[model samples]
Target: MASKQQTVASFVETAPPGELSNVVADIKALAPSEAQALAPAYKKYNEEQYITVKLPDGNGTAILSPYNSLDNNRYFDTATETSFEVDHASQKTSNPQPHALETPHADLLRNLHKALTTTSSEHFPTSSHTITPTNTDPSTLTILLVATKFSPQNFWNARWRSTYTYNPSTTTLAGSVKVDVHYYEDGNVRMNTRKEFASREVSGGAEAVGREIAKLENKFQEDLNRGFGVLGEGCFKSLRRQLPVTRQRMEWEKFQGYRLGQDIGGGRAK
Candidate 1:
């Protein structure tokens, strides 16, 4: 049998450079508690991290870790090789919901605008999102939001896109990912970044191309979650009105509200 050093050396030889510890952990099949021991020594490993470049020419590459979500849980379009991690407001939803900034709309919109610009970052580590507004031109302001997902254990990162027009109360978001492995794409995913571009196409069936699409979707979800937090609590609450509650339901809702307050803070009893 190979010595421990030789075994680790073999793993180091096959795995990506600078990830010897990660490979060794996999080979050793350490228990969860045991794995915890190695965490501190290899905190910065990039074995699970990914960097996808949106090429200006419409062909891009996604090289990184395997995604955790699969078809059963998330959304994907294999024909176009694109995936969606959070379809929270998906155009495909059966009962599509519309969310907006809360009352005192101006203040909310201003806050959201600030949040989008300040917290959101661009695809590459070095770049960032851009906002364009025209007061003299008499056009609505344009805000671009970039969302990302990064998993340290897996060492992966992903990027997704969304846009909002506050005046119109409109939001449009789509997800994306990159691939360097062999797979057939029915078409490329057209996108606009520092420049407009698309994905490169390849051909392969579900079994062969499934994982790539899944991982890409995983990254898209991760990146997408990074956004929407800057607007503060209850920022995206939907609007609804209370109906005439036939006297009985009215009393109940009122009592329920009081009870809720009590539960929250003992009805603010001093």
Candidate 2:
């Protein structure tokens, strides 16, 4: 009769006959030749330990690790290897896929957070500006409606920005909070908001972050509607002011592309 295989956890708890060495040997076998060079230890997850391995030929790099949820002798890591292909964008380039799902609004949100928390308001006082808060804390997030402007003379441009701290309950929130409200004027203006968390440990992790952002987006929409209405009125005022009048040809002035005054027939003006 054949002897039954022992599990890693069981082997750890009880020193079985030559089984410890066998487990190490098993890891060595399953791990790649590159991992062998580094001498990988038996890991709990995926039956393989984390190892950093590189190609002998060139500057190519990769980190490969096997992961498993539970300890089972049947499901040990087998033949762990790193591919030559790597995305420089991914710090964990050895992993098959990117770690964090970076949404499209990442850049915009990052800039907003940066400007609101650290910089002072007086830096750029015109066209675009950042509003400085008198009281700032790691916890206690607050948003102030600083200033939003639509150009009275030229309504083609419009913008708004504000500062806020993202956390209220210090006990519940870990990591410093940063929040910024940003408005950019394109041809058509519709407000959109997004949020992302950094690697630092948070109180509730992603779940907490999701809840906070949902609240922020809703708040953003409410204010956005109000701002839109006011800015729209400004745009209409400017447009009406700039509307062409019927009786206004007294002198030789720039009008259309042609010389359309009393003496000047329809011809290109110099």
Candidate 3:
């Protein structure tokens, strides 16, 4: 009997020209249908809890049952929040519907979110603000600004997304800034930075944390004002001109001496 690999090799060797290619094309054609069928199964498995158990009366037989399902119930809803303990530290995360931000920490995030929106709107008129992961402590506040110029007629798009978080318990302020410039000619420039600032006061109380928040707000506002200028300069000039080498504008003046009418082979132009 031929081995599996040898059998495949023999089939490939004996097939007419393009038969192997046709087989590969057919497989590629089925990928979309396979992916479509798999996507829902993946989502369902992720959202539902199940356990596989062996049957006592049969060999290689098993059944998947909903975890902790009631015998009288046909369907069960899984818990929204997951919790685990690791080395005395308990961590919990929730997957629930969006809710309002009402905690004191959320109040601080809301204030920062408002300020960031005000700051970014100055440079980018088309900007959006959102507070993400409303369930997490010290929720992330993000502002995204997008700008596109039609000088090249839909040849490029640029965007800047900035995220900030303040933790009152730790007296720390964190910022993540990202800039992306994508060109239609298969070119891109990306810049990202993450930094944290701590309070300088010896007392790590509410007043100290408040001061840190005020200072961070001011500092970030100034950075936004200056950073937009720097990004504009960097993105449109530095890397944008260098990538997709075919898009560069040639310096005709520098090559004037090598042109047909110019001096060549020790002979001057007439």
Candidate 4:
């Protein structure tokens, strides 16, 4: 069995673009030999997540989660379980039906912008005054709006519920554990930060607003894990030290209506 530390080191060493291809080639080279026993496990692990360097020559890198087999069932299965049906009579019914398509967060932000700008009875005149989306450039403004929606404050306020229904036996190691442990140990925090920055820039800065939410979420997860491990030892004490600065950045972004300079202590967000 591979040591967790060794697995993490291997991932980190191969995570970079110029190096990752070489690493994959090495893995391929190993398939007929030492790593043959683990080939099935490796194939499944590769399917879960992979790194993509957008501009391999430049600094651009992205962690891609392309079309996993696991994600499709989540959306489709719910409708089947509910037994909801739509017929011609119901389609022609004169009552207003809520939008059937499940909207993505990005789409919701766009709708929020449209609602803020367009005049209607549902939207208050004062609300329009509070948010001026017209004068601002749509590309830049949309990003800013999205960022505000997902700010750390808003994310924490939203109701959150999650449960892990399946747990592997403690006695034996499993393939799933290998994949998860690989990610947790080998994933690049800096790459994640860059991806967050680029995504915000692409989405009209909404991607940037996600960083704060990400920070809070990371802290929350850390605290939860620590709470489970040792009594009275909150994991966020060192992490919280940086919150004041992030709060300042959030405020600056809110008021100035632009992204702050990306010098968050050498881009570590700590």
Estimate TM-scores for all models. 0.19, 0.24, 0.36, 0.22
Q: What is the lDDT of residue 183 in candidate 4?
A: 19
Q: Give the TM-score of candidate 1.
A: 0.19
Error of 1 at 82 (Å): 36
**Cα miss at 5, model 4 (Å)?**
26
Candidate 1 — worst ten consecutive residues by lDDT sum?
A: 88-97
lDDT at 237, model 4: 48
In model 2, which runs have C-alpha deviations exceeding 4 angstroms?
Answer: 1-209, 235-241, 247-270
TM match of model 2 to true structure:
0.24
lDDT of 1 by residue, 1-270 (tens): 985544444444444322344566675574444433433222222212222223222343221112212332232221123343322211121211222322334343354434433343223343223223322221333333333444434444334443322232332222233322111134322222222223323133222222333344455546544543433234434322344433223455455556544443445544
Native-referenced Cα lDDT, model 4: 0.27
Residue 81 lDDT (model 4)? 15
Which candidate comes out best when scored by TM-score? 3
The C-alpha stretches of model 4 lying farther than 4 A from their native spots are 1-44, 52-54, 67-212, 231-270
Looking at model 3, which ten-residue stretch has the lowest summed lDDT? 83-92
Name the lDDT of candidate 1. 0.33
lDDT of 4 by residue, 16-96 (tens): 322334455565565434333443333333323232212222332221112211222111111111111111111111211
TM-score, prediction 4: 0.22
Q: Which tens-of-lDDT digit does each residue in 1-270 have in candidate 3?
A: 975444443433332211334433443465533332332232233112121222222222111222222232221211111111111011111222223443455455555545544554555554444433323442422222222222235445454444444445554555544444445445433333433444233245333433444465457658867987897797646755453234545566775556544433334666
RMSD of 1: 23.6
- The alpha-carbon lDDT assigned to residue 45 of candidate 2 equals 19
Q: What are the candidates' C-alpha RMSDs?
A: 23.6, 24.6, 16.8, 22.6
lDDT of 2 by residue, 46-92 (tens): 12211233333334422222221112211111112223332211212
The regions of model 3 sitting more than 4 angstroms off are 1-31, 34-98, 132-152, 169-171, 186-270
